[model samples]
Target: MERLHKLFIYRKKLVRPYIEQLLKWMDIITYVMSALLIMTLVYEHGFLISFQEIGVINRLYHIVWVVFLVDTTLHLLLNYSDTRRKYRGLAWLLSVMLYLTLIPVVFHEPEIQGGIHTFWAFFNSRLYHVILLTLLSLLQLSNGIVRLLGRRTNPSLIFASSFLIFILIGAALLMLPRATYHGISFIDALFTATSATCVTGLVSVDVSSTFTPEGLFIIIMLIQIGGLGVMTLTSFFAMFFMGNTSLYNQLVVRDMVSSQSLSSLLSTLLYILGFTLAIEAAGMGIIFLGIHGTMDMTVREELAFSAFHSISAFCNAGFSTLPGNLGNEMVMHGHNTIYITISFLIILGGIGFPILVNLYETVTYEVKRIWHHYIKGNKRMRRKIHLYNLNTRIVLIMTAILLIVGTVVIVVLEWNNAFAGMSPTDKWVQAFFNATCPRTAGFSSVGMTTFSMQTLLLMVILMMIGGGTQSTAGGVKVNVFAVVMLNLRAILIGADKVTIFNRELSHDSIRRSNATLILYLLVVFAGIFSLSLLEPQASIMALVFECTSALSTVGSSLDLTPTLGSDSKLIIIILMFVGRVGVLTLMSSIIKQKKITKYRYPSDNIIIN
Candidate 1:
């Protein structure tokens, strides 16, 4: 026994260094394979598939798959304890899948041709092989992104760069021959790609009529990635599979999710993804049920519509599979349930993930405390809990106030104008949707151009206010709007400090908010001015609406979007990019300003006003 123990120890010592070296090489090889796999998928699906090319594609796919399988197996074996501890059943499931993928290799030719034999033969068929390869490709792609992100430090830069990369890739894919029914220009593809990647949903061409199924799928993927933020998704996969999240990674995640502490970063990420999927799934079911028998679509088509709209609504992307967007009779009439459910999803998504996490923790804590007090008869367990943070309080209060006031304002202004032909119920529903949509959702149940000038102006304001920070929604952000308002109120009241919920707002926070607001306005004004010059035939009101929509990342647009000059579209694209990545973040990423100064400067006051 002693001799065996000594031998085991010696073996482990010798293998440790070699395992580490192998892992480094595996990382590089895995990334390269993932890129190759993506290229393969693009080539196969983007163009006409020839019978002769099938064999070559199959061989390349098989080689990449074998490498991935081996790499994953070795990784699991080398870090079994860590993998098991982190993923537990997931690790076992992956192992099972890997083994299952090898069945075709093991049994190249089966003698039997019926019953179970037939099933096995089908499983080993080319169709199954492609499906398996596709799954492996997605895994490798995710793994590659995670590894790449882990090596980066600046979370803001990574966040910005990831969107740019996704936009470029999406554009390239959309330009493929099979992606669009009629071949699209590169600029149009780039616009569509940026629109999808930024989750802005502003399209130069009609999505439903122009893009093929494959192109639509790519657009959906971009929306999902854009809405969730690439860094969050990549990090979740990394922490889930690797379980070796470094402190630097934790720090970056902490900032990205606006997490209060490093310890809860991983849990927070899990909650974000879990909540998103859960909400989207529930929305999908309701939407599917609502639109099933009403539309002319088959089961598969209805399912795709539900999934696409559910994702788009939850992401606040505003992309609809229907030609007329939400204004289509299919969604606005018998599908009232779809409209209401989508509205709920828009609200939930626009509310921000950090706020969702806060609500989750608060509810869970309170539930546990109540259960302990009632069931266990322990008064000590029911100690007072301060569940709401300042940010959460401010966001919730602002969001509620905005939604309520905006709804009321819209209902009143459009009661006789835009709501003239609709029933009271439909009127109220459309009014509520308009209110929420401008909170960066971008969906509209009524024609935007038909609205009264008052309603249109109100929409511009609501779009400008937008939703919360660290959310898929974009604008000046609710927090920034709140801060700016509080500051203005304090100035009017002659208060020395901006205070909210008995907490003094920090100087830096106020400054950043003010700067962001000013910069946002400047960009909007500049965009409007430029568009006016480029498209002189467009009305001033339409120009302002489009500019605000673009700057706020609200995809709503007048009929002008499709008719704009290339210069105007380019301006909108730039606005969408800036809006998705905040003005402040984009500025910081571009110009690396020093965070602190070594020396202090004297302050001087200049009289004005």
Candidate 2:
């Protein structure tokens, strides 16, 4: 090792500048390759490329592949130690794959060529090239994005812009010839893309009839991207693959993911992604089991349906491949388990990532304790106290209260109304499902038209008071609502402090909560008022419901979605964007905030009834 190190030092002194110069050129070339690769993918996927076009595309892919092949090889041969430590396994695996692409070309003997044929078919296929190129493109693009993060830019702006970029990309992809059936207009495509990207389920067109499997796949991909904030996915990929990012970059990611410490930034991101995929995978299985052999769908169709809905539900996107959504007769009748399972998945997703992390910590601690006490024969066990954080406790309590109350109320109100023909089990399941959905899960067990005015109003309220903070859910988050209510209680009791669970809320929290509620109300009211003018034919009640649903990022509608004017759709699109990105976040990005002053002005009390 010492001898090799000395030799490396000698070689570094001999040609260090050349190696450094090569690395710089490789960076620019890799970025160009990423851009070219994406354009090629879009060209191939978006249009029906002819044989000649395919050949051209394949040649382009080969060029990109060779570029990466050379890039990876140079890094390995020159800076192997640095690459190993920083890029870690990802760089090594990519290097191996890059070399493997040459196998079919290198091994030309007839006997050996027989085995290489299979290798050629796979490693040289368009699909393989697509995957490989996509990975490399993302890596390159993400590095650029991470570099941007290291700069002193407004994170909120970047956050909003990331979603915007995806929405536009998705809109463009959906406009592709093969993505939809017959065709689609740009406005409708934008609406669907915005809806999917925002995880807001309102569709101007029927997803089942209008979109092909490719389109649906695009929608689901958008949902997943939107479910996890766009910046989050990019940051995780960049950090997880590249490793040891700038402190500023780490801080930005830590803030985005709500990591408690710098050390746990990577782990927090992993937990978020890991928990999402695991839950969706598990939910997919549960859904498949519940609707198995009953939907008349083949196993492949069932699995696809299950995976799509599982992701949509967990993302709170509420997109459904079926025409009537979860209300489809095939799955809505006896498949109560699917409804219940979806409801729980929604809850789990909307419960917030911070709470998930907290729960994970609690679970891990308990498992270790039990393992030590029982398995290791240790008698002394640490007492479990305050396992839940203040935020977790507040959210869990509020969520439980909302779910239980909403379910009971819906059952009582909708028993002989919308759910008249259903059995007791179905009623409870449907009620819970509806109650769960308005909190940001878009799935519905019954048509919106069948619901009573009172039920609709209840749903509107539930939509306003959405799920937890930093969750896939939208609307005025439950955390803010809890804080506002606590503040209200404090005022009612003539107390200055908002206290709960032996913890007094910060003044800033109270102020922000009030601001958030007021902003949400303004946005919802403005949307409803504007929609009423633009969609004069729509009933006031329907307009109100539509406005609330759109602004809350809840996918439910009063059968008025398809009939809305283009102008009204644009309004809803804006609301969905605002709701998902957050009114405060948008405002923060747009409206420059003044630095905090060292002195405070005189304060006065306002007159109130």
Candidate 3:
């Protein structure tokens, strides 16, 4: 027994490194196979396939399946102890599924078959192929994402690079002939892909009319991934599946989710994913019910529409299935419930995940405390109520203020102009939506071109202010805006320190806010100037609006995106990318931040503006 135990321990030690190496290679192969599989599927869908072509495709799929079967088997066998401990029965179930695939491949007897034949038939079905391919593709994608995020030294660069890779892949997928009804140009596809991946809704082509269902699916996927952020999504999967989140990964995620401590990083990510899925699912259901028996489309189409719009709104992507966008009569006529639901989704999405998490924690703690006090007469529990962090307080207060002020401003300005044709209730609803939409949701219930110049200018300011930091919404961020305001107030009051909620703001925070504002303005102005030179015939106001929209990732346009020249489109694309990633993050990724020196240089005060 002692000899056998020693041999088993030695075997485990020898196989561990081999297993790790095999897993690494498997990830690389899976990445390659995923790309190839997507290409094959796209090709098959795009072109009419002959029997020979179909046979080739089937053979390719079989090879991939065989590779997966072998890899999964080895992985299970080598890591049996760890897998059993981590995943319990799930590990065994996965192993079974992998092994079952081999049965269909080995037993090819056409004459002598009963239950086996039925099983083989089901396994060979198209639905099975799709399910298997999709699962493999997701697994491969998640693996790639996890590997990319494991970079501890330069997380920002890795994060940016991942999005760029996704953009390229999405462009390639969209450039396939079958992706669009009419084949799109590479540049146009790249633009659309970037826009979708950035969750910015600036489209070069009419999405509804140009893209096929496959194209729509790709766009939606990009939006969802982009909205949640590539790093956050990948880390979530890494924690759930691999369960090997290193301390470095935890620290990086701690920064991303704005968690107070490294210990809560995993839980914070789970909250983000769970909250997003829950909200989006609820929005989808509400939208489906609201539009049910109202639209002329079939149930499937309605469900698809609901799902698409729900995701778009929640992600703040602003991509719409309807050609006319939200201005379409199906929504604007009497679907007030749908409009309200969409607006709420936008609001929730705009509120950063951190803020939501904070709120959830706070409410949960309060509820528990209340329950304890009422049921158990625990007075100590009631007194232990936790206060929200400063970031959460500022974000919530500023967001509410902006929403209310924006709504009132828009209602007052457009009541007799844009709201002239609507009833009082509809007018208020539209006003509220228009206000909220400018804060990065970008959906429009009315024609933007029809809005007066004053209203457009107001929208530009609101867009510039943007939604919360670390949110799907883009722009300067509400936190920065609030900080700037507080700093200005301090200066005006002749105070020695800039403070908010009785907490002193740091000099670094103030400096970053100032730098962000200056850099944002510079970019916007530069874009406007360049666009003016490129599209000389376009109105200056329209050019400014376009620049602001691009820089803010607002997706709202004054009928200018499609009409712009290649140079203008490229500029807008760059702006959208920078906007979504944040000017600071992009700069940080490119410019190596110098470490602080203990010895300080002489300081001097500069002349004030």
RMSD of each: 3.4, 3.2, 3.2
Error of 1 at 135 (Å): 4.7
Q: Per-residue error at 120 for model 2, in Å?
A: 7.3
lDDT of 3 by residue, 1-609 (tens): 999999999998988898899877875787788778877877887676899999999898877777777666666677766555544243345456656666666777456678767888876676676567656666557656665556656877877888888899899889877788979988899899989989888898999999998889989999999999988887776566555556677777778878779777768888999999999999999999999988898999998999999999999999999978999987888888888899899989998998999889889887887889998888775454336888889999998999899899889988999889789999899988898998887787799988888889999999999999999999899999999999999999999899976799999999999999989999999999999899999999999888888889889999999998888889998998889888888889999889988998899999997
What's the residue-level lDDT of 152 in candidate 1?
74
Error of 2 at 450 (Å): 1.7
Better of 1 and 2 by lDDT: 2
In candidate 2, stretches whose alpha carbon ends up further than 4 angstroms from where it belongs are 1-25, 73-85, 104-110, 113-127
Task: Give the clashing residue pairs of candidate 3, or none.
Answer: none
The numbered model that scores best in lDDT is 2
**For residues 1-609, could you state the per-residue lDDT of candidate 2 as single tens digits?**
999999999987989889989987997899998988997888788788799998998888889988888888888788888777778578557667767777667765345556556767677566776797798789889988888888878999999999899999999999999999899999999999999999989999989999999889999999999998898899988887788788998898899999999999989999999999999999999999988999889999999999999999999999999988888888877888888888988999999889999999999999999999989988877768999999999999999999999999999999999999889988988899999999897777798889999999999999999999999998899999999999989999999888999999999999999999999999999998998889888899999888888889998998898998888899999999999999999999999989988999899999989
Deviation from native of the Cα of residue 590 in model 2, angstroms: 1.3
Ranking by TM-score: 2, 3, 1
Worst 10 residues of 3 by lDDT: 86-95
TM-score of 2: 0.94
Q: How do the candidates rank by lDDT, highest first?
A: 2, 1, 3
Give Cα-based local distance difference scores for all models: 0.85, 0.90, 0.85
Q: After best superposition, candidate 1 residue 347: deviation in angstroms?
A: 0.7
